[model samples]
Structure formats: C-alpha cells, structure tokens
Target chain A: MSKPAIAIDMGGTRIKIGIVKDNVILVSASIDADSGNGLRNRLPDIEKIVKDLMNGQKLTPEDIAGLGIASPGIIDTNEKKILSIDKKFGDAPEIDMEEWCQQAFGLSFCIENDARAALLGEWKYGKAKNYDNAVLMTLGTGVGSAAVMEGHLLRGKHFTAGILGGHFIINYKGETCNCGNKGCVETEASTWKLPSIAKEYSSFSDTKIAHVSPIDYELIFKLAGEGDFAAMEIRDQSLQAWAACAINLIHAYDPEILVLTGGIMASSSYIIPYIRQQVENHAWTPWGKVKIEEAEFPASAALYGMAYLVNSVG
Target chain B: MSKPAIAIDMGGTRIKIGIVKDNVILVSASIDADSGNGLRNRLPDIEKIVKDLMNGQKLTPEDIAGLGIASPGIIDTNEKKILSIDKKFGDAPEIDMEEWCQQAFGLSFCIENDARAALLGEWKYGKAKNYDNAVLMTLGTGVGSAAVMEGHLLRGKHFTAGILGGHFIINYKGETCNCGNKGCVETEASTWKLPSIAKEYSSFSDTKIAHVSPIDYELIFKLAGEGDFAAMEIRDQSLQAWAACAINLIHAYDPEILVLTGGIMASSSYIIPYIRQQVENHAWTPWGKVKIEEAEFPASAALYGMAYLVNSVG
Candidate 1:
C-alpha cells in the first residue's frame, strides 16, 4: 500500500543513502564523501551505493515513489537543485539532480536544505511532531536552523528565510563571520571557531584548554567538570552565546518549541537545562514559556526527512 | 457605499481619534492621554473626544461600521482587549475595552498593537503598499517594529512576534535591556537611553554634547553637522546599532522592503544612507537588495490602519 523511496542525506564527510518505506529505512548505505573531489566527481559512487542498497532491499525503480535529497547550502525545493554551494560541496550547484534521478532510477525527485529537511523529519516523525510552530537549531561545525511557523516551512523570497539563523548577529562587535557578518552565533561559539574564541581569552597559555589539540565541546566540558577555570569560563561563555542564539531565534521565528539537535547536543545533560533556564529568564513570551527539548533523531533525521518529503510530494 | 469607522491611535502623550471611510480620514480629533490619570480614568475623555468629532462631522453610530483602537501594548485582537500594560498605561490590561465600547456606543470594536496597526496602514495605503513582504521600524523613544510576510501580518502564538523586533539582541555582551536581554537595539539606540550611552564615552565631559541640557538625536545630528567629535562618534554608534537592527530584522522576517519611520527619521539624510550602506555591505540577502525606504505617513498611519482593520472585521 505504501511505496518505498530513495533517501539521501549528503553531508560534508559522508553520504548516507537509504531505501525507506513507512517511515522505516529498509536498507541504508554510506560512503566517505571525499568532498575534496567535489560532489560532481562523487555521482558515480552515489549511484552505485543507491543501486546496491536497493538491490540489497530487493527493490526496483517501480517499487519506489521518488527520490529525496537533503543537502547543505541553499536549496531550491521547487527546482530540486542546490542553489548555493558551501565549502563541503563546491560543485553541488552544477549537478543536475533531477536528471540524475531520472537516469539512475526513472524516478521523480524533491530536495530541501539539510537543516530544513531535518526539522521536517523531526516534525513528521520526531520530537517536534506535537508542535505546529517550532524551530530546530543544529549546533556543530556551524549552526544550522529551520523554522516552521504555524505548521508551514518558512521558505522566504530567496529560500533562505529559516536556514540563516546562525548568521544573526549576537554581538555586533564580536568577531567576523565567514558569511560577511560580525558576531554571528556561529562565529561566537561554533565548533570550527571555538578554538580561536578560546585562544583569545586572557590567560589561555596557563589553561589546560590551551594545550588540548583538536579542541571540541566534549574536551571543554570534561575539563570544566574537572574544575579548570579557563575551561569553565569558556564553557559558560559558549553556553551564554548559545542561549543568546536560542533567544534570538525565539524572537525571530516566535516558535512555541525549540528543538536542539546536532553534535553539541550530545552534552544535553548540561546544555539543555542551561539554555532552557537562560531562555526562560530572558525571552519575552507573555503567553507561556517555550518548551526546549533535545531532538529525537541525531544522525539519520535528514534521511527520514527526505523520505517523508518524497512521500508527501508523491 | 462605504461606512465610517471611529479609529483611535492611543499613545503615551496623545490620543489620535478620527472618523474614517474608504481608507480616508474624514474628520480627526486628538486629546492629551494624561496617562498619569490611567487609561481607565481617561476613558470618559476619549469617549467625549470621539462623540464631539463624530457630531462635528455630522455622523452617528448608525452611520459607522465599528470602532478600531490601536494601543501601545499587547492587544488581543480577537477579544478586542488590551492584554498587556506597559509603564505608560498601567491600567490598560484591566479595562474591558469591548464592554467600554458597548457602553459608550452601540458599535462593534477591534484592537491591535500600535506598531502592527501602523504597518498594516502602510501595507494598505502607504509606501509598503507595493510590496507584499515588508518590515517597518519606528525609531524614537524606543524601537518599534512590525512585519508583513507574504502579505500576512506576523502575529505569533503570543501576539508578540513582529512587535518584539526592538528586543532582538544585537550585542550579547553590550548592555542590560529592560526586557532582560543584553544589547537590544532599543537599549543601544533609543532616545530614552542615548544620554546614558553618550555619557559612557571617554571624552564626554569635554565635548559640546555635555553642555546640552537634554541630549537627543536632533541635537546630536545638529552637533555632528557642526563637526563635534563626541556627537559624531555617538551618532555613528547609534547608526551602527540601527544598521545592525535593520540587518537583524531583515534576517529574521525576510522582507522585500524595510520602511523606516518614527521621529528619529528627522535626520533621514544621514541616518538613511548610513543604514542602507551598512545593510548593503553586511546583510546576506542572496535574492536581491531589500529596498530601504521612508514611511509615507508617520502620524496618521495607525489611525488609517485602525480604520482598515475595523472595516475588514466589521
């Protein structure tokens, strides 16, 4: 009664392909993106992986409804194309996804920004299913966000409405962001920028954080738990930045629920309560307090979202 | 034939009331709000002003569709009630406006936040009429904003969505806002806080600005024109704050046009160009440039908006 769909969640380091039906992934496969080769060069590998997954699941093109892709960068959902390519997939915009879908599987296709697709996935089958108005913020190398206002995905004039939450300036005089803005939340506390932010502290050389190679939130949280002063300070500052970002997003989109996702959420025991407390104290929601919660799916959210999207469109 | 509607724009200092029909104000009247006397105490005066204006215009309740009041607080448009009271009108939330309207005259009534009403007025008859997605920022004592996205007013779950644009934190480590946030646009650039902001500067005592009894944007702009360094510095900072505010709004609401209004626009020559340049350089709008324009009607926009609202809901 339900048709299977080919779902792909394309990220910076890995490509996840799956055959999904009835909100379940029948068979999934993944490969190193080797993004240095560019998305254009990886087409053949992606085709092979999808075919192998379908064959392993005993599925054919006729058994599938369509294909859905969740990708980084600005996605033109109507065109089923990636409009703007970020560092991970420099050649993504040049790829004809619809043509590829047609040739590889004789299937129609749909696409959405990875963050938006994740939010959609959450809304359809995850934590945000109960909320009509919700926002999803994924904290990792960069902050990625999506807003669903009154149950509709906020795709603005340029299709960048809900996805650019990371770029909202939390501190106008703070630091320069890659997006050509100063003091963006991502620039202030994201994984890629955290090292520099931590290094700029007053006594960085004396702190244990200064000696740690490949700096990340996990190491910082661990050091902070061990009563390292500098680590504690940076952790608090990062939390404050994230809290400010959540408040900013809350003010911007006016969502009833905020879904916190991505790698940083692995520290949910410390992160969730801190952000919730900060937002509860600061955000001006007269009607009621916004519910802050961890995302239901951590890794395969966008994959499920892609399947959901394909099914919805089909 | 169009029916007349009694429209009111209630503010801290003045109450603007008008008899409007077909988007035009037929006869208008005003009275001091005497806000110290409380909104409940001034209800009779408001009723008298409305009655006198209607009588002078040779109109009666039978000839009018309904009454529309735009007030400076969280307004429950559904119940025609003011839900939240600010400092200026402490008694607003307690007053049953629907009951008062029924007692004053046998007429239906509706209400909306003043800024939202102004935006609607602009959307219906002023500069923003050409664009479906637009944002309006009124900068003076405080920064007020309203957004129309895809031709619909953004009233969030709490009725605070578009109205809280001023409270969006531009600097997380900047200043403590009354709304419990740090470095809100209002906290940085509003008229009420400008003097304190100026006083915090290094050379404030030596500058010509220190001699000015009441430091305001008008005096600051004039002194900046006359080449006063302190005034120029403060003015530049203010413009930066405002520019950051505009970009924040642009990122948040995704508008096609940003309408600058309020008393501070008196320095439009310097203010507009500075903000436009900053936003053009910093904002990440990939579709095209958001048209920055001045509001067509500053004083009577809310009155017209109230009339439009009354007519639509009558």
Candidate 2:
C-alpha cells in the first residue's frame, strides 16, 4: 500500500485538486478560477482545499508521498519552472511552485504541462496502456497536445516539442491566433474562438442558438442535432477543423494511437466517427491504421497523471 | 584516416553518385533517371558509373569502406530496406538494396530517406554542426524535411517522423496533395504542383510564362523580378506557403537552427529575408529567435550525408 499523493490540475476556468492513490481518486474538489487575476492569489485557497480534502479522507499531510501540479503552460520539468505564460495563468511564470509546495505541505514536488501530464496518466493507467507511440489532444478552452515517441516523451531542447498541435496553421488566410500564428486550429475551432466562428455565419442571428450567452460545443451539437442551419454549419466547420488538426498530428508525429480528451469530447459520439472517417480518407499511414480512441478519464486524467509523476519521484 | 566511401543520391529526374572521404567529394557523376522504369533496371548503370569513378581515382572495390544510398521515400534503416514508395521511386520497396550491394561490390550498405540524409550531412559537416536541435527543409520537385531533436534523429514508429514537413496542410480547403491530404504545403508550392497552381490564376495564360514548358520556380522568380503580375502572385503564394511550412517545422520540433536546402533556394536572396520576417512576426518562440540559414551544400548534402552514415557504421 503506497502513500496517497496530492494532485492539482489547473485550468483556465477552474482548478481541480485531488488526493489520489493506486490509480484512484480518493477525494477531489474544484473551485472557480479568476485566471486573469493570476495564480499567486489562489495559493491560499488551494492549500485550504487540499487540507480539507485530506481531513475528510481521514488523513494528514504526513500521509502523502508527494505533490504534483499539472499547469496549463510551457513547463520545464527538470528546473521545476514555468517557461511560458498562457492566457489563463498570466503570473504563473513568476511563482516558484516547488518552494510553495515545500512551505505549504513539506512534500516532494513535480510538475508538468497539463496536457503532457494527462498523456502520462493515459500512458500509465488508461486507454494508451499498451502503445509505445501515442499522442493526446485535449480539446478544451484551448487545444493542448502531447506526444510519446518510441516509448519516450518528446521534450525538445526548449521543452516545447510535441505540445504545439493546436498552433499548427491549417488555414493560411484564416484568423490570427493569440499565439501570433495565422489560421491555427485553435483560432478556428477551440472554445475561445467558438463565438466568433459562430457569428461568422450570416444566419447566426436568426438561429435558435443566437441569444444563448457563453455558447459552447454542447449547445452547438444539440442545436445542430435539432437541424438548425447556423448550428449545423458551425458544427461542420468545427469538425473539419478538428479533422484537419488530427491529420496534421498524425503526419507530424506518426503515433500508433491518438487519444482525444478534454471537455469537447463529451460529444465524442458525433466527433469520433467524423474525425475517424476524415482520417481514413486523408491520413497517409502506410504501415497500418492509427487507432483513435477517447481517453478513459477525460476530466481526472490530469489528476492521475500528476499523482503518477509525484509517486514515481517520491 | 577513413577509406573513401561511395554515395548515391536518388532524385526523381536524376541520380547523383560520388566518392567521398574526409567531407570532400573525390569524384562525382550524374545520370538521368527514368524512374518510371523502376530502380531494378538502373542498377547496372549505377554500377558501371561507380566502377568508372573508382578506376579514375585508381581505387579498387576493397579500397572503399562502405556504400550508402540516399533515396526518396520512407526507408527503414534497421532493415536496410525501403518501406514506402514515392512517385520518384515507384518500385523501390521491392528492391533488396543490401543484397544487391553485397552481390555487386561485397561492401556493407545502408539506405536512408534522402531528406534525412541531407539533414545528417548538414548536422555533421554543414551549418547545423553546433546545434543539438535542428531541422532541415529541402524544397525541390517536392518539399522534404528531417529533424534532429535533443541531439537525436526523430525517426518515429513508422520511420516517417520529421520527414513530413511538406505534407502539412496550410489550406485545408485547397487542392488535394499527391499524398492525399488537402491543401498541403507541397500542393500549393512545390515544383511538381507548380503548373496546376499557376493555372489556377486567371491571368496565367496572358503572362510571359504562359509559353514555357514545364515552368519552374526560377523562371517565376525571374519574371516576378521583372514585375510580371501572374509571376509575382505565384511567387508570393509560394513564399507564404514555404514560410508557413517553416513555422510549422519550428513549432513541431523546437530547433535552434533551420537550414533551407534544395534548388528553390537558388533565390535565397529573396526567400530568406521574407521568411525571416514572417517567422519574426508569427512564430510563437518566446525563448529566442530561430536562426534560418541556406544549406551549405544544397546539391551535394545528401552525398556527404550518406558518406558519413556509411563511414560511421562501417
């Protein structure tokens, strides 16, 4: 019986904190995140939540093996530093996460990019268990990606390799991405771009979904299912953008299995078959078909992943 | 001191053969390749050329350390076999190259994708010498690419990693590529697709280039220099596509140096600055600027590359 580990999965809208052991989440909780305000102010709340979760589970800080965080930005695992800032966590680069964890819980610490952490979780305990070459794409607030090649995680010289899938330019003349690239997949298909993309339809104002505030993929899928013209068009374009992104990933990394995760996958019933068909028609894999599967633990994969990392290091 | 090794670089239209030692080409020759007829029939001609070159240098078969080939298509170096067929080398997969080399010269033989060969050449003796992470893009009849990440060649599960730069889709709604992907950089910019892409312009028939047979990038650059409208449009589109491909490569494999090779780079005076500006404006590299340089040996890098591989393994 190994000691339980504390894991934090930071997202743009919410922060999920969990206590996990042996591939299971013993306890978990989430709080709304005001990402624009930055992560520094949220440390106290995270600490409190972790303590309360541990207490409810009848445990103490001493019972934990280590602490791990899956943050949404470019991370340097060896140096335990955030290399780049995402829109969600603007002040993340300045915070010394290792030191904070040390002073707070007195536990050993490890950190990785949230997408890469999720991949590690899947690679260790989920759908990617048997494959040596795998790619994970998290379709959420922003599209995040991570790849494993020949059983080794592909972290390049700057620690940015295999994590820029959403940033790939799929439409040269399309919209500009926040990352400065033009026509990136994220600029066309992600949640942040959904409203703008939907408004581009001339009939958008006449549609049933037009008045909805904070429109999401789920709503679009529902309206499209109900046969609304604007919704159907938006849904089709988004699907193609995702399919193009998938083909690009397949060509870029040559992974044996591509695992799709994140919130958008809640509509995998419609997304999977469509993307798989497009891949079948377009992807140029001569060796064999790349297996496309949904991640087993879409929401908690990052928690499991961070726990795995912390446990291994501890 | 190492013995001179034989190198063969196979292209769609021509074959470049050379004897190399200490990074110098002792003797070299070229022969037009009727690739449609397959590599099996070309073996006799290649053998004769090798013998003649060696005789002129006063060297016997035993004087050579080994033989290496840089051929177009996906190659499995471990099996010393061609795994996929390219339009250039349609019958390459069926040819037992190692066995043929053994029967012909009683020398150890190795083969690699030509783009990877060129990259190795650049990495060992050319512009990429000091950088541990580097990417090489070869723009010719087709755009080809290979990458070195963290001081290792990125050969993925199917031996196709880092070699699909041209196949990346930059215009998802654009023309279908020979590789079956839609709107690939190659479909928009490569020499093989040049005629079709040019014809898509309404004024193509009225331009000075209308009468030219088998139009190439050089003529387009020359005409564009003279302010020909159709030529200028074609040139600009090609440059942008190449720039997008460059950014894709940088984002995909975080390289310190990007070496641009191939015949199209003959106009590096125009291509380099334009691409540098676009990369500066669009690439998301926060760490620093990625240096872009022309290949030191655009025509003969693969010759040097194969020689290095053969000598090292010999």
Q: What share of the true interface contacts does each candidate keep?
A: 0.53, 0.78
Per-model DockQ: 0.69, 0.82
Find the candidate with the highest lDDT and give its number: 2
The sequence of per-residue lDDT tens digits that candidate 1 reaches over residues A1-314 is: 55888989887778888888756888888989898789888889989988888888778888898999998878888877788766788888888989988898889899999999899888988999978899999998789999999878888766878888888888877777888888888888989898998888898899999888999999989999999998899899889888988998898888989999988887899999999998999887867899999999888789888888888898
The per-residue C-alpha lDDT of model 1 at residue B69 equals: 92
- Once fitted onto the true fold, the runs of candidate 2 whose alpha carbons sit more than 4 angstroms away are none
Considering every candidate listed, which one attains the maximal DockQ?
A: 2
User: How good is the docking of model 1, as DockQ?
Assistant: 0.69
Q: What is candidate 2's lDDT per residue for A1-314, written digit by digit as tens?
A: 56799999998999999999857998899998888999999999999998899889988778898999998878888989998966777898989989999998888899898999999989989999989999998898899899998898777888888889899999988888988899999998999999888888888889987899889999999999999999998889889988888888888899999999988999999999998898888887888899999998998888998998887788
Query: Residue A228 CA error for candidate 2 (Å)?
Result: 1.3
lDDT of 2 by residue, B1-314 (tens): 67899999998999999999857999999999899998998999999999899999999888998999998878888999888866766888988999999998898999999999999989999999989999999888999999998888888999889998999988988888888889999998999999988888898789988989789999999999999999999999899999999999998999999999998998999999999999889987878899999998888889888998888888
On a 0 to 100 scale, what is the lDDT of residue A295 in model 2? 96
